[model samples]
Target chain A: MTQDETMISVRNIGKRFGSVVAVEDACFDIRRGEFFSLLGASGSGKTTVLRIMAGFEAATSGAIFIDGRQMDAVPPHQRPVNMVFQNYAIFPHLNVADNIGFGLRKLKLDPVERRRRIDEMLELIKLPGFGDRLADQLSGGQRQRVALARALVLQPKVLLLDEPLGALDKQLREQMQVELRALQRSIGVTFVLVTHDQEEALTLSDRIAVMADGRVLQVDTPAGLYERPCSRQVAGFVGNMNFLPARVVSQDGGSARIDVPGLQTTCSISAERLARFGSDISLAIRPERMTLHRERPADQANSVSGVLHDRMYLGERTQFQVALDDRGTTIAVSSSTTVAERLGSIDPGAQVWLSWSEEALIPLGND
Target chain B: MTVTSELNAPAGADKTAFAGLRRLFFQNESLRGLVLLTPTLVILSITVIVPFLLMGAMSLWTQIGFDYTDDWSFRNYGIILTEPLYTTLLLRSLGMSMAATLVTVMLAYPMAYFLAFHVQKNKLIWLIIITLPFWTSYLLRVFAWRVVLGYEGVINTGLMEIGLISEPLSFLLYSKSAVIITLAHAWAAFALLPIYVSLEKIDKSVLEASADLGEGPVMRFLRVILPLSMPGVIAGTFLMFIPTVGDYVTAALVGGPDSRMIGNLIELQFGTVDNWPMGAALAITMIISITMVGLLFMVLSRLLKRWVAA
Candidate 1:
């Protein structure tokens, strides 16, 4: 997005609490109406960055611009952003309508107008006839929806969510994820979500910024992040990536031939993903990208023979751990249940050949 | 010979009896709970319930010239209702206690807030420090207040030394304000405990949520923090007001004849006037008034909760 279209411009933001650095110099542009997520594990400083943007925290160094205004001096109340806290933070003393209408008091709308807007929000959150219910009466999922409505009612320039679905169970979390996505689409408001769940970030965000050790490792589209991570850290964090020690054989204009010592095979990959290192590199591939075969295939250019170390059935897919002959290390290979059924004696102790296209191997230099 | 025969009937019978007794006591949950509570229940009845029942019965009798006659009448109550002396003292007691409650709770709330929000480590130490003065005897504390608020006491003497006053302020002691002030200081710890607990129980995120929702500090306090802490405020108010209403020691120590409350009058009736029924009646009247005020407060608090929520 262009600079003019950027809703939040975080310019080299750094935060420190006394001696410990919580977030390094992080910089990113969140586009207007974009669902952007800061994905990381615990202590990755994603929430700290979100808090800084919301003005609940002041960055020790650097500046933040929201809708083209410097937010360094602006307090949380004056900022054009609202947050749904992790615990929902619904006022136990206030009922549903009061909680949603909390921020709207600044507008000083007439009673009827305020009531209409509150009811509209209740309807949006699918809580009809729940305006009078106190917060204590609502269930966890209901509380979450109310918290969303409370923030969304203000129609702020941006909505910041700090692990909003972290407290939910597996089934409810998935349901809320879908509902949250649909709600964002309907509102067309820019959303900045901070979560430790990589799957959640990938599923809900238009752009995901993977963070590690208080640093923004990479920011990319979900598919791009999954398919072509810039570093081994980002690739490994986003999904199950198997790494094999490799060396660059040669480099052409558009592709690079890499030699994998562990697999004892040489494969050519797109030069665009070639890491900036000497010859030593690490070849990373997703388990689902590599296929298992009954015998060595003559047509396949890249193939490695290995013994099946373990077999795991995961409903629709089956995972196979293969121990390569050249290197005793095991690599996980996944296939659809149908493909696994076609392979004879799909059990441990069976000999299998693992094969994949050259594009499946992402060259991440020894991280 | 018959008794010997019964005793020797069956040794198994005694075993069966013991087994049944054990099962009856252990298997029945409610019964077991009652048995466990029996000691406490008996002690409470003897120390509290029996005295309360006797006081209620005595309040109905009349004292006829040093002899308490069980004529079963509300003559003592009728006298208290009709006498201007009794009525004024009761009203003054209620008014002073109300002022004391308000002052104590108001003063305690900020200290409690400080403890809850500002002090991070050694919270128990801070709490103990807040209540350190209360560890002293209540009467001793009242005497200490007497030393502070007396005509030639700490406040007046200190002011005089600073050349802020020409003479010791006579109004500082032997007045209704003096008693109120003493009561407030003595009961401050009670107010602080509840207020601190409720304030500490408040989720920090809720305050953040309020700020995020576009409320500055002042408005946030008025709308969110203050309302959420009302339970504690109400509890503190009750704890101070209810007991202080019948407080005679503070008045006796620092108050003049003009500041004598219903408690002082009740004390006089029981001790000097030698009228037990009259004292009992006066005590009952104070309780009834206090109960009415308590109920009124409950209703008002309910309305306040609803109003804030709505």
Candidate 2:
């Protein structure tokens, strides 16, 4: 991206707490008006990266540029960035108006302008006339909005949010995820959110940089990352998957022929998707892609012989665990409507067939 | 119908009673908290409240020599208020204590701040060091201060050694300045601990958040640190000021007639004059004055809080 379009450029940024490296060699460019997310599990340095970008943490060695200005040595307050902390960090001593206008107060804005901005922020957050209430008086969702208003009122070039909705319950969390995305879009400022929740990241981010062990694993759109994971770890982290140990029997075009112990099957999987070449390579398949059959299908390349172990009846679908002959468990999800017909009222020990499309069997990295 | 169905059941009745009790406990958390703190309440009433009540009652009575009677009057209060000498002594004590508390706070604040936010390790060591002077005998410490501030004391000797002054400064000893210094030293621990506790209770993350909001170190200190530590500042001031007003030892050991505090005058009326009534009256006057000052400080603290909130 060009310098003008790129709101933040993190170059070789690293952070170390004594001998332990919290984040290492992290680099990324965030464009203006993009809703970007740093997705990772706990202790994966996503929060550390956001803090470094926000100038709350000093880089052990590296530099950050916000709007073409070096920010490695700049303190957090002087930077043109505001953060919505996981805990909200609303000034407990101040009411809603004061909390929202805290940064504005530092600007020496006229009282009328400050009040006007605070009122505008409150309305934008859908919390009109909440100025007189204490932060503790608000509910969880209200507090989250107040936090967002507090950051947005500053009109920062970049807004860093660290687990912004992690404190809410599941229902509210899901609702706020969409609300936050719309808010970010409406405000037209680059938003950098850090969260460990995969669904939250996928739902909110226009682009996501997946992190693991203080390193960026992949940077892609949410759909791209989900549909095309670069590694077995990323695939497992992003969604559930079933793996079958296989060896590459032959290679043709961009696809590979693989063999498994239980069946001499020639499954078509992409060669470029493989992380390593050896006698052992796992063919990763998602559970939703697998189909269960009562009787063996006439002709299927990627098919397995198994016995139906048990069935978990979810509201929308049913997940069946099939015990394969190779001592591996393969799970298959069928819609509740077709589950009974496909399985034919199967018991725990009924013999079954698990089959999937050729494109469903994606080769994964050795992890 | 369901309630009627379960009404005859013994299990349901027992469960309902237990649930009600649990709900009651949950609802009156303040009462439960007081119940949990019964030991503290009992100890405070025995050591503090009982003596205070007795003192208040004693202040209203007249005593004839060593005789005790049911007779009560405001004669002692009248004597204390009418006497300009006692009133002057009381005012002098208030001034001295106020100065000492202010000086102690000024010295303790930066030290407390450093210990709270700056120091990464061995914090307990620094705390002990700040409290080291108090570990020794209070009388010994006062006497030591007297010696140090004497005509041929360490300050004069050190100045002579440095060739800054040829002779000792006689005006420095046996005066209000000496009393102020001695009282400050005596109460330094009181001032430091409350301030330190307040500083320690401050959420470090709040300060970090303030800094992250674009405030410089000085502005953050003014806007966050000082305001947040106000409770401790008030606590430390009251902790030092209230007791210092009644202090007589430092005055006797180091102060002259002009520097004599309320405690010294009260002791004089009872000991030399053998007039318990006047002494009790003086004691009542001091208590009332100190009580008013303490109440005023509390109000001031509340007002400051509102201002900070604004």
Candidate 3:
């Protein structure tokens, strides 16, 4: 997105609580109408960055601009942003309609207009006739919807959600993930979600900023972040990445020849990798990208013979852990249930060969 | 087959009846609740209900000399209604109790809020300190207030030492305000705990949510904090008000002649006046008045909450 299209611009923002730094020198631009997520593990300062953007916290250094307006002196209430809190903080004393209409009171909307807006919000949240239901009486998912409606009713320039679906069960969470994405698309409002759930970030976000240790490590589209992580940390955090220690032999442009001790071969690394030549780098590959076969695959460029150490039968896929002969490093390989069934009776401790294309090998930075 | 079935029917009926009885009395929630409540109910009947009923009966009897006449009448009620002294004392008691409740709750809420929100370290220590006044006897606390508010007491003596006043303030001690002050201090602990509990139970995220929705500090407190804390406020108000209205000690100890409350009159009737029936009548009136006022306050608060939310 262009500079003028940036809805929220975070400029080298840093936050410190006493002696401990919560977030450090983070800078990014969230585009207008984009569903952006800050994804990280706990204590990784993702939520802190979201809070700073919402003006709930003051950054110790740097500045934040919402629609090009500096938000340093703006109080949270005055900022053109609203938040769906992690706990779904619906006012227990007020009914659903009152809770949703809380922010509109200051605007002095007429009674009929207020009712119309509340009804519109209720309908938008798929609770068309639940305006008078007591807040405490609703179930968890219903309360979440009410919280969303409450924030959306204000028509904020950006909506900040702090682990909004963290309290939900797995099935409900997945369902809400799709609903949240659809809701954002339909409204076309900028959404900044902070969550530690990698699957949630990948599913809901248009672009995800992977954060670690109070800093933004990488910001890219979900597929880009998963397919090509800049460092080993991001690669490991995003998905089930198998990292094998490797020594780069040589480099031609962005592509490199790397000697993977576990794979027992000099593999051709993809040109997309940014690692330097003759350096100790790590070869990372997604579990699903590698396939296991009982016989040696003559056509494959990268292949290793190993003993199948363990096998787990998931409903749709079977995960095989193979212990390579060289260095005795164990690598995980996954195949679809149908494929595993076709190659039947591949027992643990049986000899197997793991193979993948050269493009499947990802060269990651040592750190 | 018919004879055998007929013979077995009675035994089957008996088994079902026993099972039904067990379910009704033991397994059922409502019946089980009643059964569990029986002990407290019996105790309350003996300790509270019996005395109240007897007092109600006695209020109707007239006491002549040293004996209560068997002839039931409304003589004491008539005296209460017609006599300006009794009516004035009752009104004064209500006003003084309300003043004490208002002051106590106002002072206690901020202290409770501070304890609940501001103090992060050694909260148990602070709570114990807040309740430290309760360690002393209630009468002793009243006496302590007397010493502080006395003509030559702490305020007057300190003012004189500072050369701010040449004479002791006579109005500091034996007035309605003095009774109110003494009673509020006596009930401070009671007022603080309930309010503190309500404030503590408030979810911190709710405040943040309110702020995120564009409410400033003052509006946040009014729209969120105050409404949520109303239950404790109501509890604290009644806790202070009910007992203070019937309190005789503070008024007797610090009140002037003109500041005598209905409680003092009731105490007098029960003591030197030897008019037990009249005292009983006055006690019933106080109960009825306090209940009426309490209900009115509760209804008003409920309406106020609705209005505020709207």
Task: Give the top-scoring candidate (lDDT).
Answer: 3
Candidate 3, A204-318: lDDT as tens digits: 9999999999999999999999998888889999989999888877778866677888887897765555434238888899999998888989965578899999999999999
What order do candidates take by TM-score, descending? Answer: 1, 3, 2
Expressed as tens digits, the lDDT of each residue in B1-310 for candidate 2 is 8887777698878889999988988899897897789999999999989977776677777777676454777877877778898788999999999999989999989989889888999999998898898789999999898779898898988888999999998777789999999999899989988888888888776776677777788877777777778889998999999999999999999997779999988888779876666677788789889999999988988787767544
Q: A216, model 1: CA deviation in Å?
A: 0.4
Task: Please tell me the TM-score of chain B in candidate 1 relative to the true structure's chain B.
Answer: 0.90
Across A243-282, the per-residue lDDT of candidate 1 in tens digits comes to 9888988999898888888777888877766647668888
What are the RMSDs of all candidates, in order?
A: 2.8, 6.5, 5.3
CAPRI tier for the interface of model 1:
medium
Error of 3 at A255 (Å): 4.5
Candidate 1: give the clashing pairs.
none
**Measured against the native two-chain assembly using Cα atoms, what DockQ does each of the candidate structures obtain, in the order listed?**
0.74, 0.47, 0.66
Q: What would the TM-scores of all predictions be? A: 0.95, 0.89, 0.93
- The candidate with the higher lDDT, 2 or 3, is 3
RMSD of candidate 2 to the truth, in angstroms, is 6.5
Clashing pairs in 3: none
Candidates 1 and 3 compared by TM-score, better number: 1
What is the per-candidate TM-score for chain B?
A: 0.90, 0.82, 0.90
Can you write out model 2's per-residue Cα lDDT over A256-330, one digit (the tens) per residue?
Answer: 777766444777667776536564777777788888888888766667779888887776777788888775655
User: Which residue runs does candidate 1 get wrong by more than 4 Å?
Assistant: A252-255, A270-272, B1-29
